[model samples]
Target: MTLPTSYRAYKSNADGYQNLQLTQVDLREPKPLEAVVRVHAVSLQFRDLLVAKGDYGLPTGAGIVPCSDMAGTIVALGEDARRFFSVGERVCANFAPDFLAGEPTPENRAALGGERDGVLAEYVVVPAYSLVRVPEHLSFVEGATLPCAALTAWNALTGSTPIKGGDTVLVLGTGGVSIFALQFAAASGATVILTSSSDAKLALGRKLGAHYTINYKTTPEWDEEVKKITNGRGVDHVVEVGGLGTIERSVNAVRLAGSVHLIGTVSKGASGIPLIPAILRSIKLNGVVVGSVRQFEDMNRFIEARGLRPVVDRTFPFERAREAYKYQDAQGFVGKVVIEVVEE
Candidate 1:
C-alpha cells in the first residue's frame, strides 16, 4: 500500500483541544517488524489534556497530535509481523509501549502520542510490535478505551495482587479507571464498594456491580463509610484514584496489609496523606502507570469472555473531536468518551 500526502491531527491544552489538518509526509513503509494502521477511533484521557496544555512532558515539538488510545485496522505490515498480527485485523496500540513486563526501556518510551505523534489522526503508523489484536466482537470505539484505562485496572488488580474470591474491593469515583476497577474486581468474586459524587451515577454503578457507594462530596469522610460497610475490618483492596486528596481516606479504609492500587488524581496539583496512619496500617501502595502488551491481551480476553460492556458515555464525530476533549475535561461523563475518525 502506498502512503497518502497527509492526515488529520489534534492538539490539546488545559483550555481544551483543537483540530488540525496536515499533508501526509512520506511515512516509512513497514520495516520488517512494524504495521501501519488506519486509525478508526481515538479515546480521550485526562493525560491528553495535560499533554496538550504543555503541562506533562517535553514540548511535543510543532504539530504534535493529541491522545494516547486508538483502535484501528491494520493496512500493512513489515516482514515478521505475521507472527503476531495480520493485515486487516482490528488492533489497539499499547500506551506505555516501553514498559513491557517488568521494567521500562528507553526505546519503548518514545511511544506513540507522547513525545511522538499520537493517534488523533486519520492514519498513524505504530511499531508492528506495539499492536494488540482487538477482540473480534469489539468495536473500534470500545477497543479504543482499553489500552489505557482497562489495562491499567487489570494490571493493578491482577499483576500486583490477584483478587481472590470474597475479597472486598473499594473503588473511588465513577471515572473510567474506577469504573473499570469495579467491574474487574467484581468479576474476581470480590464484593465492591464504590464512591462517586453523584447518587444517580452511584445507582448505575450499583447496577454494574458496586455493592455499596458513597457520595464523597456529601460525606467528606467517605473512608469511614468504607470501614462501616466492610464491618470494621476494612476492604481488602482499594483502587485509589483520588491521589493525595483521598490517599489518607483510602489508607484509613483498607484492612491491615490490604493493597492500594494508586491510579489517578481526582484532586490534582496537590497530594496530602497522613503518613503515620498509612504506615501503621502496613498497607501496600503500588504506583500504576498502565500496563504491558501481555496485560492488554489478558484484559481483552476477560472483557470478551465476560461480555463486559464498557459503558461508553458518548461518541463524537471527527469534526467534533475537540468537543470530545472538552467533554472529557468537564467530567460530565460516566464512562469512556470516544472520538470517531474517518479516512479522508
Candidate 2:
C-alpha cells in the first residue's frame, strides 16, 4: 500500500517555555525491519512538560516530537515486518527501544520523547520488534495511555517484589501511574490505600476500588494514618511518586521488609530521605522506569482479560496539542490526558 507523502506532527523547539508547533513533514517508507503506524491517539506525561520547558535533564534537540505514549494502526510494513505485525493491526510503540525484557542497563536506557523522537504525530516508524498489540477491549485513546504511565505502574507492582493477594498497597496520588497502580492492585485482590489533595478524587479512587483514602493536605502526618489503618504494621507496598520530599514518609509507612516503588518527583523541595527509619524498617526502594516490550505484552494480556479501562481525564484534538500540554501542566485531571490524532 502507498503511504502519504507528508504528515502532521507536533514539534517542540528549544525555547524554554511552551514552544510546541504543528508542522507538516515528509514521511519515509519503513526500512526492512520497520513498520509505519498511523497514530490514532497520543497521551501526555509530566515529563512532557519538562521536555517542553527544556528542563528534562536529557538533551532534547530542536524539532523533537514530545510525547512517549501513542496508539495506532499499522498502515505499511517493511519486508520482514510481517513476521511480527500485519498491515492493519492496532499497536502501541514501546517507550524504550533497547530495554525489551530484563533489568535495565545504561546501554538500553534511551527513552522516547527525550533521548529519541516521540509519537506526537500522525504517523510513526518503529522497529517491528518494538510494537505491542493493543488490548482487544481498549479504545485507541485508552491504549494510548498505556506505554508510559500504565507500564511504569505495572513494573512498580510486579517488577521487583510482586504484590500478592491480600497485600495492602499505598498509592501516593491520583495521577496516571498511581491510578493505574490502584486498579491493577485491586484487581489482584490486594487492598489499596491512596492519598490525594482532592477529596473528590479520593472518592473516585474509592469507586475505583481503593480501600482507604487520605488527604495529604489535611492530614500532614498521613504516614501515621497509614500505620493506624494497617494496625501499626504499615502497608505491603508504597507507590512513592513524591521523590525526596515524601520518601521519608513513605519509608515510615511500610511494613518491615515491604517495598517502595519510586516512580516520580511531583515534589520539588525536601529531596532527602531519612535513612535511619528506612534502615530500621528494611524498606526496599525500587526505581521504576517504563517496562519492556515483553512486559507491555503481558500488561496488555492482563488488561484484556480483566476488561480494565484506563481512566482518561480529557481528550484534545490533534490540532489542540498545545492546549493539552497546558492542561497537563495544571494537573487538574484524575487519570491520563490524551490527544486524539484521528478525529473520527
Candidate 1, clashing residue pairs? 5-24, 6-23, 6-24, 12-52, 13-53, 34-128, 35-128, 113-118
lDDT computed for candidate 2: 0.91
CA shift at 275, candidate 2, in angstroms? Answer: 1.4
> lDDT per residue, candidate 1, 109-202, as tens digits?
5655667778887877777767788887878888888888888888888977788889999998887888899899888889999888899999
Task: Give all candidates' CA lDDT scores.
Answer: 0.81, 0.91
Per-model TM-score on C-alpha atoms: 0.93, 0.98
- Listing every candidate in turn, what is its Cα RMSD in Å to the true structure after a full C-alpha superposition? 2.3, 1.1
Candidate 2 residues lying further than 4 Å off, grouped into runs, are none
Q: Distance from true position, residue 328, model 2, in Å?
A: 0.4
